[model samples]
Target chain A: MDYFIELFFSGLTRGSIYALIALGYTMVYGIIGLINFAHGEIYMIGAFTALIVSTVLTIYGFPLLAVIVLTALAAVIWAASYGYTIERLAYRPLRSAPRLSPLISAIGMSIFLQNYVLLAQTSDFQPFPALIPEFDFMEPYAHIVGSSDLAILVVSAIVMILLTFMIKFTRTGKAMRATAQDRKMAMLVGINVDNVISITFITGSALAAIGGLLIASHIGQINFYIGFIAGIKAFTAAVLGGIGSIPGAVLGSFILGLTEAFATGYVSSDYEDVFAFSLLVLILIFKPAGLLGKATVEKV
Target chain B: MIFSKRMLSILAAFALAAGIASNASAAETIKIGVAGAHSGDLASYGIPTMKAALLVAQDLNEQGGINGVKVEVLAEDDVCKPEVATNTATKLVSENVNVVIGHICSGATKAALPIYRDANIIVMSPSATNPDLTQSGDYPNFYRTIASDDAQARTLVDFATDTLKVGKIAVIHDKGDYGKGLAEFVKSFLEKDGKAEVVLFEGVTPGAVDYSAVVQKIRRSGADAVIYGGYHPEASKIVSQMRKKRMKTMFLAPDGVKDDTFINVTGKNAEGVYASGPADVSKNPLTKKFRDKFMATEGAEPGAFFDNGVTAALALTNAIAKAGTDSAAIAKVLHTETADTPFGAVKFDETGEPIGIGFVVYQVKDGKFVTVQ
Candidate 1:
């Protein structure tokens, strides 16, 4: 029972990270109807940006909170620029071309970004200083749980709550929803669809930047390619949550994370991925839309 | 008709002159083909290896030349893929390189060996550690300066069973040639001792962010220790996950996870993890000097495989110095010469591999790697 609880919390913490990243994927897909593959590269860029900023600040003897805030700002700026540039250079030109063209271009852009970072950074795993101070919170339950696990859970929950409030109450959030539902209708109704779309990207990228910062803080070092796997898992989370549904992405992330944790804890570690992907396949086959996602009929 | 004939003669004359110039340029420089993972996850090792090779060429030229002829090092990015390695080998052969130093991964090196052997070009690896590369009876030109996976595995198993007194052990591998091979060796050695029971044996994909499932299983398996034969990235993730789950089993790994990146990635969770690798960093004065130089120049300590790159450069330079410019003669001298390197004295056995390099065990304590007896 203790083992199970530990696994459950571990999974939830991991899932929270995926959920945060998935929010970025689902939001852009919701507004633009394009699966921004380069978003993963954007996340990687964010992490690197945060890493560089934090390292520089630490060298200058700045306090941890100051370093973290500066790093977050840098990550947001870098990721926003990257998202904007990718959209302009790769997606905009192919907006009128076949759907496959833009998707292929996004993949090409991802590869280009990966190689660009590799060439610039020399393909080494540089250490990212921990921005969060280590505090033992679950000391009483040390045998069953750990401080890092509790920290990941608490931080993730706070971030998610704040995000939920932003999307539900903010003005830009309503415009985003309006744009997602009908781009043509939104434009006809005097909505600045392009601006709404860019804002949606900025919002999603900011969240991803936060995720990148947390991940860098959790994992002490990072490299150019760190985002690829996490990005895939987050995409899986988005799909699991009903891609385009914000709350669904969060739910899906938790499920994926917890499942992986439990599987690795009780079953074989090698089969953790097999189990996760299999669940995704099973969910797709049975629900077709995802656990929290709505089913949409395809146009004949 | 006369004007048309004159125009044809002029075009043919120009084509002939261009062909001659191409051939003349090609004949002037001896190209040494180098292959490594220049653009993928392992590019950290590959890029530095290439840089070391280039430095060797620059050093050689400064001392006159290789047999009165300037040496050229042409690099190809294999991306650590076997198919790419084969393709790169074919391309290098087509380019008529006299020798090569590449295909960093054991599996990739194995794939390219047949092509290089068939083309009669010597292929040396700075980091390939799979024992089967030379033992497979197919490679005559393949050589590696570092100790093999088996050697590192033996060192790790000895530390776990004899020093740590780990009664129950769980083994995890990354499903790659290096990881799987090392894990298998460690498992076999542990099983032979009968002091340890193998509770769980599993493989994980590389670059995974979460490894809670495997960590949880190990926790439940009643294992006192876990050995992961993989690179630092995944190892760090696993360690972090284990810390999250509150599993207290001691972690162990081979040289692949012995980098400072492991501690950086895992933070405080990296403490107490034992690692076995060639003690090149602590065993040699030249390595210490090079480490100082690298830190002074690069503003940080070189990564785990930096010394391996330097040793490879030293080996090639020594072979070239002895052979006096002929690559075929250099290959002969490489077989005969036994010289001290940054990693200590290295001598190739009959199959063109280093003979007696031993592995050392170390443990992470307070974010630093400290040698363990």
Candidate 2:
């Protein structure tokens, strides 16, 4: 039972990261109806940003928390700019073209960003400073919580709660919902749909940047290709939760995380993905619209 | 008709000049082909091996060239794929390279060997560890500087059973050619002398983040130790997961999981894990010198296979020095000559396998690998 609890906490920690990145995928898909494949690259860029900022700060003997804050700010700003430029340049022109065109362009953007980072960074795994303090909280509660596991869980949970509050209570959040539901209707109703979409991208990108920071902090290193697999898992979480649903992404991320944890704990660790992805396929086959996702009937 | 005659004369004169220049330049420089993963997952290993080879060629050229003939290295990216390696080998043959140095992964090297053999180009690997490369008995020019998986397995089996007194063991592999081969060899060797019992044998996928079920099975199987034959990434995750669950079983691994990346990824969880492979860098004087130099220059420790690459390069340069100008002659000398390398005196048996290569056992202590035996 203690082992199970330990596994649960570990899963939650990983799931939180998946949830954070998944929010970007769900938000962009909600507003633009494009997958925004390059969202992963933005996450990668955010990690690199944090890596550089933290390393520079460390060289000057800055406190850990101060370094973390500076790195997070840098990552958030860079990711937001990257998100804005990608929307303006890559997806905007293809808005009128066939649906496949924007998707292809997003993929091209992703590849372009990956190669660009690879060329710039030399494809090496650069060590990043551990921004968070490594406290041994597990000593007193060894049966229930490990220090590393708790830190990841708490950090992720706080981020998820903040995101939930932002989407539920903010005015821009309402506009995002309005734009996602009916772009044409939202525009006719003076919603300024374009601004709402751009804001949505910025918000999602910022959240992803936070996720990137947490992931780099958790992993204790950064590389050019770290975003690729994490992005896939996050996308899986979004789909599993019911894409376009904010709360759904969080729920889906937890579910995916717990499933992976359980799989790793009970089965071979190698088959963790097989279990999570298989669950996604099974859920899609039966529910077809995800747990919280509404089924849409295409007009024939 | 008069205009056509003038154009034909010009074209004929240009073709003749190109043919003459090509022949003259081809004889002056001997081209050696080096192929490996330059741009994929294994590029970490492949890129450094290529760099070391280049450095060797540079050093050779600076010291009065090879027998007064310039040595040119032509590098091709195999991306660690067998099909790509074969194609690269064919292209190298077409380019008339005197010999070839790589295809670092065992699978890729094996796939490209037939092409190299058919083309009669001597091929040597700095890092391939599969025993089958030379065991097949079909190629005379193929060589590997590193100890084969069989040798590593024997060393690991002996250490786990004799030194650690690990009686019951669980075996896991990544299911790749290298992983599966190492696992089988260790398992077979362990049970061969009726000394060790393998409680569970299974295969796992690579690059996974969790291993709860596998650990649970090992725990239930009543095994006192777990032997993993895979790379550092998976090994790190497995060790971390075990620690997270507080499982106290001893973790053992082969050479592939012996890199510092294991400790980097696993952190404190990596402590006490036993790994058997080549001697630690600090063990030998030559390796110690290289390590100090690498740390001072690169600001990082060299990877586990770095010495193997350097040794391989030295072998090639030594053969070139001994054989004089012709590449085929160098190939002949490589098959017959014995020379000293960083790994000690390097000599290949008739089957092109390195003789008397040694393996060491080590344990992770304080986030660094310390040689235990």
Can you give the TM-score per candidate against the true fold? 0.70, 0.69
- Runs in model 1 lying further than 4 Å from the true structure: A142-148, A155-170, A298-300, B1-148, B241-248, B263-271, B281-356, B365-370
How well does candidate 2 score on lDDT at residue B263? 77
Candidate 1 residues B1-373, lDDT tens each? 9999999999999978876775576567656677999997989878777766675576567777666667788999999999899999998877777678877888899999998888777777888987888777678787787777687887888888888998999999999988998899988988887889989899987876656556666777899999998899888878876775567899999889988867766777889988876664565787776666666656775764567776766676678657654557877877787666677777677776776556888899888999898
Q: Per-candidate TM-score, first chain only?
A: 0.94, 0.94
Which fraction of the native contacts appears in each prediction?
A: 0.63, 0.14
Query: For residues A145-228, could you state the per-residue lDDT of candidate 2 as single tens digits?
Result: 445556656766776687678767898877777887888998898898778878878888887788777777665556677778
Please compute and give the TM-score of the first chain of candidate 1 against the native first chain.
0.94
> In model 1, what are the clashing residue pairs, if there are any?
A264-B213, A264-B214, A265-B213, A265-B216, A265-B217
Q: Considering only chain B, what TM-score does candidate 1 achieve?
A: 0.64
> Model 2 chain B: which ten-residue window has the lowest total lDDT?
B207-216
- Candidate 1 on A212-262: residue-level lDDT in tens? 878766666678897887899999999988887778888999988887877
Interface RMSD per candidate: 2.8, 4.2
For candidate 2, the TM-score of chain A alone versus the native chain A is: 0.94
lDDT of 2 by residue, B1-373 (tens): 9999999999989977866776577689767688888888888878777766666677678887777877788899999999898898888876777778887999899999999888777888988877788888877779888887698888888888899898899898888888888899988988886788998887875543234456556666788898898877667767765776577889989878888777775777889999987654456665565556566667886764677776777777788678754557866676677766668777777777776456888899998888898
For candidate 1, give the lDDT of residue B350: 71
* lDDT (CA) per prediction: 0.79, 0.79
